[model samples]
Target: MTDIDPSVYANYYWVSSQFYKFRQEFSDFYKSALLYLAYTSVESLSDSFKLDLAFDLSLSACWEITSTTLESCSHPIIKSLLGTKVEWLYYILQAFNNGDLVRYQELCVYNSALRAQPALVENEKKLLEKINILCLMEIIFRTIPLSIIAERTKLSIEDVEHLLMKSLSVHLIEGIIDQVEGTVHVSWVQPRVLGIPQIKSLRDRLDSWLGKVHTALLSIEAETPDLVAT
Candidate 1:
């Protein structure tokens, strides 16, 4: 039997550690894939092998993974894909990350090469539904009227309600939909593998909440001086 290198085992454990970090933090599958490809001594492999990896990563980004965000596209592994045959795949990832439905539609309309992918073609409706769900997640914070969701997702109010129901059923989001009032009161969103922009958005929301709490405390203190004294 040919002897395997001990370093291969070390690299496998390292990649596993990175994946664990990803689950706990904001990193995604692409980032972990990049780490594996970069550190696994795959530099000696042929271009075809790298291209295969890119294609698999793109497919995972589009359908296989639960995460819609692809914030790490600027990484070297993805960046090197520029001007390559899979360049459209890069833009597709960006569209998903940003929840740009119009851009995604445009790509599908213009890029016949993208349309040729059997998996994407077969799952077209599923992909559209996933993107719409991602669009809802991007826009929703706490509570939103159904009309606004319809406008944002480019779906009818009825469709919006159905979408929310599907999202709820899948545990993608936890919320209550008020058909009477035509609104959704979202209590939680599933944590996604985020990029820097998403992380900053989260930070800004936290700061805003802190500011509001501080203002409320000041108001309470001013209105109840006797209570504070007691």
Candidate 2:
């Protein structure tokens, strides 16, 4: 196995800091395997592989991002871990077969980074939630009064304000208005997921409510005018 560069990975801080923990316990073979796994995981997310390795190896790792610990496998990462082939025969049938292995691997690394960054995930979740809420309303051209949206969504006014600012800052909404203050903020109204084509590709992979949110904003834009218009 080739030498694994810590810099190439996004989890450099944590993994590098913890490198000593696994260095001695895991044999050279195991270390090599882990490096390969990391390499393959990053690659798999971007490109298909011809080998019959299960794609889930990378996917599963990404899925386990919430956990700080390493995933458990039936076979330990001893000498047997060095090989690239899947331990289970079933996986060979499921994900392998001359596909985008590189891309899959890249995605795994991306997933790892995303998982490690809880703050980022939380921020994104908040942004998506805000987007969905605005989209749900039928008033497309007009802004929904913050108080009304806050009351309807069961979010606090402060939370609504934060989300609105976040959305506007991110350019998800075209314009915004603070009714009480008579302040109108014009922004680039680009939804994170735009149009049906993007929706089709992202719908399955995105959080369920995220799609609902875009729809909701459109609905609100279509149905309601910012009643507080000055």
lDDT of each: 0.75, 0.40
**Model 1: CA > 4 A from native:** 1-48, 68-76, 226-230
lDDT of 1: 0.75
Q: After superposition, how far is residue 97 of candidate 1 from its true place, in Å?
A: 2.4
Best by TM-score: 1
Candidate 2, 81-184: lDDT as tens digits: 23443333222111121112333234335555434544335555543353334432312335456665565445677776765676566555657667586343
Candidate topping lDDT: 1
TM-score of candidate 2 on Cα atoms, chains taken together: 0.27
